[model samples]
Target: MGTKGQLVTDPRAAALASKAWPYEEARKLLKRYPEGKPARNGQPAPIIFETGYGPSGLPHIGTFNEVLRTTMVRHAFQAMSDAPTRLIEFSDDMDGLRKVPDNVPNQAMLTEHLGKPLSRIPDPFGKFESFAAHNNAMLRDFLDRFGFDYEFISSASQYEAGVFDDALKGVLRHYDAIMGVMLPTLRKERAATYSPILPISPKTGIVLQVPVEVVDADLGTIRFTDSDGEVLTQSVLGGQAKLQWKVDWAMRWVALGVDYEMYGKDLIDSGVQSGKIARVLGGRPPEALIYEMFLDENGEKISKSKGNGLTLEQWLDYGTQESLAFFAYREPKKAKQLHIGVIPRAVDEYFQFRGNYAAQPLEQKLGNPAHHIHNGAVPAANPPVTFGLLLNLVGVLGAGATPAQVRGYLANYVDGEITPELDALIDHALAYNRDFVAPTLVRRKPQGVEVAALERLDRELAPLPAETSAVDLQNIVYAIGNDGGFENLRDWFGALYETLLGSSQGPRMGSFIALYGIDNSRKLIAEALAR
Candidate 1:
């Protein structure tokens, strides 16, 4: 609480503590526990911030979004309050696997394990003890890579270890009350068969979904008919049974005393239903931030099982992790198309925000996405050039552009030696151009006066020394376009981009020539004329 308590004295921190979304979330918690730490059993109870992961499929960008955003809120709370806080990265691994994910291998093996608890199924990947274990390990690895401070809790382990014993009992005691909250929300057919408790079959090891025939609140047991038409009595406690997802969500809130959590907008109804059940169990529901879901390029909701959106690895391939975080920080309530195409913009904006952070005023600095992305420790170094500019450079230089070659051209524009940040940007630009840009390039053949314009611009550039400034070269190009009998200057520049770069859009002509060189521009014009 050293500098944390001093947030009021530091105007920058003070500004952020009042304005930022994370700060707003922090204020909610502050209101919940006004004394900073609520007392339980005469001891200060640590506020719990929870994020849930279902290990049915590999962790995707949506998974990262929830955890990272939660971490940001957790950091905000730590910066403004002296109360101890704990982040629970809860894995719902004990839940049954309903279907095989399209992204995973060995689908035939996975099909055999349908309806069984994920932790009990054999790992199709053949790496970990079970499928859920493999996914849970991957989730941990990614979160660890980001240096997230949190405790990983497995639902299977929590149940088997009796960590949720009392909570399970509470569910049994309030079974009818919990069902009262959920039944009306389901379809008539589903409502007739729905039960809050799902008992894991001792014989088949599958989670049974049949309706509960009886509930014994005193004995903590449930009676249900099996698929075999035999009635079985199962203890609601221990790992023998688990509640339905909505009910389970509430049980966790009561058991762990979760103070704050965030969910996608799609889960609004579930959150509402769960809150009702939590109240029935005599527990207050956590404060929630409902964020919009990410969509694929087709505008369909991104699914982890379908694997339709950008994966974490795919995004990191073309952008820095900070860029991804920046993307998450912006407009959390607004839907965004999460795809490979969006990476370049996100990267450039991250660089722009980071570069401007130190020079920004106290209030602006606090409001900048870079401030929260880096957790108030924004890096001093910025990329020498934007990712968009670098992509254009790569396109003009072609696929043969090596890192050193790109750096040599960049040296002409950037004043200092290439920092590692710039160096990484160069690599990402090259990779993006090779994969996405190069395949789509189609140089338009010069028609009529377009040929004359290219020739005149080529000649105008021929006299300019390599030392000539981009501005001067730009002026020369502008004069050529103006005198070339083109009705509009935009058409002239469009001709230049399409004829020379094989793309409809390009960097500034002067900057492109400076980087691509005057001789190369001449050669490009010559090639276009020949076509």
Candidate 2:
């Protein structure tokens, strides 16, 4: 039988609980461990927060996601408590180079380097000292640009310096126990020769996956035969050996005193295995928040191997960095499709979050994504025109329009002077339309049943008053499509978009037409009919 029910009420926690679920979750954790570590002078230790990346390929959007999301929760945690926090952005550069990415240059040069540690591989781009350094530099540049407060740790350097020597020894000492935890998850065949450690061959310096012949825990040594059939014996310390990934993950948590970490849903099984290993090694596992992976437009999980998602550069080229951060802000557990198609919506939502933050109550305001997106310093309000609207303006104003021409149209539409910030947004919108939209544009004639729908749409637009509201115009467009035998509103809308913008999709037609003016709209319709 259960104990007596208790109705608990804490105003502060309740307030956070009402706004963002993440903050609510953080608040509960803090409340549960009010007297956690390092209470030297009656003050609790700073929360040790960590996120890690495997530098196998160039750091992609997926890499940035963990940092972005972890930082968001860290921000929320700061609001909920006076306890200090530290976010460690660890890079596992010691990982063996499994395969050279197809996108990287000089693939022929990499055949000799396969199975070598990432830090030891030559930078194919010749821009950085090593492949790992290049990717790490790219990651640091991005973090610096975003002003993320974090400490970057390279596993290669840490290993070489013996920072994890003790933990590596512990893994070797408890070899059988670690195997008991890991082998059950592997195929029955793989369990036979698998070892917890992969040693760098003394001859070739490549990480060798050969079967470990012996592990002497008291001696702190492991013996394995290299591919050359040379019997090599190396001390498990001083970077001579590295534990397998899951064991390394667990050991890192124990060694670094990690209190919180976030992982992609794909790592759930690994997290469970690692948690068990951490517990077996007499260390507490860090709390975790697992998020679903991002997918490409095709609904396949976005992967470096698949080359199915936008690179950080592509996203920044098409939209603001804050917009990308906003994309990560919503529903962390829900799978999202990240493609160029989503950029416009993310930008518009960023603006909306910015506008709403000012008027929101204090409790709700702190939880607003814009609060974190701007790092608590939200910019001035933006013009009502959205990225989608600016894009429509680009198409309506015609391709090859200069920045000044776009600004002039935007000024007229929003009825305000375009600020420098807004002007920059316009620049990006035009570039996006040119790169992603313009090339996809087509001027196909309406065929059969669709032809009458276009004629009916033109007839309806001709009679509308110049002062008609966008709402009324939208309703009229809807009515015209239903009457012309194209009952599917989307079909009619597609025809109108292709006719006017040379694409199958554009901004809300009513607002677009209203802003473009009756004269301009009629001229475009006539041009479409002639085509």
Highest TM-score: give the candidate number.
1
Q: Per-residue CA lDDT of candidate 2, range 1-531, in tens?
A: 012543324435534554575675576557646665566477667788899988777667877778888887787787667778899999999998988788789898877799889888999889988899999998898788878889999998889898888877778777878888999999977777677788898788788766675557766788888879878788878777777889889999988878889898889999999999998877878888888988899999887667788888888888988899899888888999999889988999889889898876555566688877775788867766778878877866656878988765555566566777778788888889888777777767767677776677677888877777778888877787778777587888888887777876677888887777766787888877788
Query: Lowest-lDDT window of 10 residues in candidate 2?
Result: 1-10
Per-candidate local distance difference test: 0.86, 0.80
Clashes of each: 0, 0
TM-score, one value per model: 0.91, 0.85
Residue-level lDDT of model 1, residues 448-522, one tens digit each, is 789898888877778878778778888988988888888898988899889889888777788788776778778
Candidate that would win on lDDT: 1
Which runs in model 2 stand beyond 4 Å of their true positions?
Answer: 1-15, 40-44, 213-219, 414-416, 439-514, 517-519, 525-531
Error of 1 at 157 (Å): 1.0
The superposed Cα distance between candidate 2 and the true structure at residue 293, in angstroms, equals 1.5
